[model samples]
Target: MNSADGAAVVVGVDGSEPATRAVLLAAREAVRRNRPLRVVHGFIWPLLGVPVAAPAGAPPHAGLRHQAEQLVADAVNAAQAQESGLRITGEIIDGEAAAVLIGESPTAALIVLGDRGLGGFASLVIGSVALQVTAYAECPVLVARGTARDTGPVVAGVDGSALSRAAVEFAAEAASCRGAPLRVVYARPGGRAAQAGEEERLLAESVAGIAERWPDVPITREAVHARPVAALTEASRDAQLVVVGRQGRGELSGLLLGSVSQGILHRSACPVAVVRTPG
Candidate 1:
């Protein structure tokens, strides 16, 4: 299915165990959003090398195409098994994985990916595709990691910027959907009591209307005088999901991701959702 038809929860699969986890999570998200689940596999090797003719009159690049198609089929079947009756589709695109997923972002409700893939090193904190898509995707991107059964608060990093406000709204909706609490965290360098009080006020202002929209979800606010990354990382230990903006007020406007966001993606103990500021 083409993304133009409707917004879907798009997932990238590579026949890895982590990819299976991603498909399962994406399936649940599609059901939650009332959207279809589209499983995509990027076939870059065929573009990099000349196609070779196969035996028995098979088309050139038949083996590679077959493998890619099977990868997509397996992902679709796994997702359907996770949630019976879920609408799911599969496709094999010819491009780099990150580029293909980013190209699909505009029409996707959300892009879900595994934290690491087969090509990723065990020593690496996160995969390159996960990092790139989280930084560049216009829509929110979720990097699936850790256990999915964590029944904790939906933690969000708030800094009173437009992007932070957007993240707060997203977190509120996520908390409402998951039947969990919303924790808004504001972290700043060591400061005076007056500064701490001012930050608290700003945090309250940022989340003012969210409670009205999600009255059933419990909301808690915390203003911590510490590094943003440290505060957010500590909060993520008990969080079911951590939400943050791609860039914040402290970051340069042109940068794709700020230091705090990059740090959280690398260190967060649970699944992290990166939301970009709406134009």
Candidate 2:
């Protein structure tokens, strides 16, 4: 993690693969946004509730702190190596990891984490840290799993209804800032869900219309098969940020979030941005 300057992206490091992935993702984001990255490494004397007594000749908490400092130093070196221009700094915090991370999560721009976390079973489908960050962070939380997105378009799910526009706007702006292409995917069921290419074509036109508002940004368009939830998930499989319209439907529209956004929040590999526009 780098020192904080203005708005920054925060990542938690624990010397695990997930933690390292989080570090890499955060570094790339910081470099792209031109903002400093804040790396926070926390250590607790207790190992999952078991306390260790200090060895005969060691000072109290000395061993823990030393190990923690070394761990954080290694994480910092790896991050700086990946992004040469990245400004980085780190510290060893004392306390519970999840608590310290949330307490220290950067409120400036975004928070990035690994899909799974440093703690818990390695074979599990999800980790406690990812779930915790998403539920509590003030700023939108991004969890990168497996391969992190370096250069790819953003895939967002939306309908032609009222709430759809909000997701589109967010996706467009995000793509513009990253200078990556924007792919707006409207997933509709077969048969009566949408009239062939009509809905998809309309969606493309709508995204194009929004792009006019930002003369400098580049946005692309698309539509897909299957239900909105499944289609969106498939589309976002290779995307950076999976943006989705919440509480909306092609049948009726208002200030409501649909299950599509909710479902993706839990399963997507990349981070999800759930946007809801008022009726």
Candidate 3:
């Protein structure tokens, strides 16, 4: 999904290492977009039928509420440290983590989440919270993973679909903002020499307006004879950000995320941004 104009960059934190990384990345994104940063902690204790207040005679900060507040406080502090003079705020919302983030997504320019968090299964490549938010959020969802690098090209996987073109638009803006080169990759699994011309033409059409829109950003188009997931994952090896459409051509209408998009999320070597045309 696309971001609303002038909206803040929202990030979810849970006191995990991955969440901490997400905070810093969100801060960077906010600065790049010239928008404010909002750090949100989804507090689930109140919704679990547990007492939110501390027991009588107990320490003032003994309640789960206090801990939740502290988590947001610490995350806000960390984000501010990462980006001094940046407009940053924090909140403790009573709801499920994924639900809270999705609620914030409607008014946010971007939603940033950790690939995995404390609530996630250790063996899974991506957390349930992250996946849920990515699937349902109203704005684009960025999952921070692997090494955080700010010095690589911005990669976009396009297939000439409207959603793929939308992803290309997002990638162009990201590349322009970072002053990095933009690589638009189109992967065609069929290795037919006779169809090479058609594939090349479609690739060009996918990124048709990107150059005119972001004249300063260098654009490269590549047509690969490989699976989309494999090609994009390999490109992510040296990319600062990888953008893909949540649902693309040939995907089932009921699926929130296309197979190639999900594969990229699970295997990309850099941060992954899932985009779709906002309603």
Q: Of the candidates shown, which would achieve the greatest TM-score relative to the real structure?
A: 3
Candidate 2 minimal-lDDT segment of 10 residues: 248-257
Worst 10 residues of 1 by lDDT: 246-255
Residue 4 accuracy (lDDT) in model 1: 54
Off by over 4 Å in 2: 1-5, 44-56, 59-62, 159-170, 195-209, 245-279
Model 3 bad stretches (over 4 Å):
1-5, 190-196, 248-252
Tens digits of per-residue lDDT, candidate 2, 118-195, equal 666857655776655554555545666545675777876767765567677767777776877778777668776665
**In order, what lDDT does every prediction score?**
0.85, 0.69, 0.88
What does candidate 3's lDDT look like per residue over 1-279, in tens digits?
233466899999999989999999999998888889999999888889999888999997998888888889999999898899899989999998988998998788889999999963678999999988888887888999776698989999998788788889989999988999999999888655635388779888998877888999999999888999999999999999999987532345877888888999999999999986654
The lDDT, on a scale of 0 to 1, for candidate 3 is: 0.88
Better of 1 and 3 by lDDT: 3
Measured on C-alpha atoms, candidate 2 has an lDDT of: 0.69
Clashing pairs in 2: 2-88, 2-89, 246-257, 247-256, 247-257, 247-258
Report per-prediction Cα RMSD to one decimal.
3.3, 5.4, 2.2
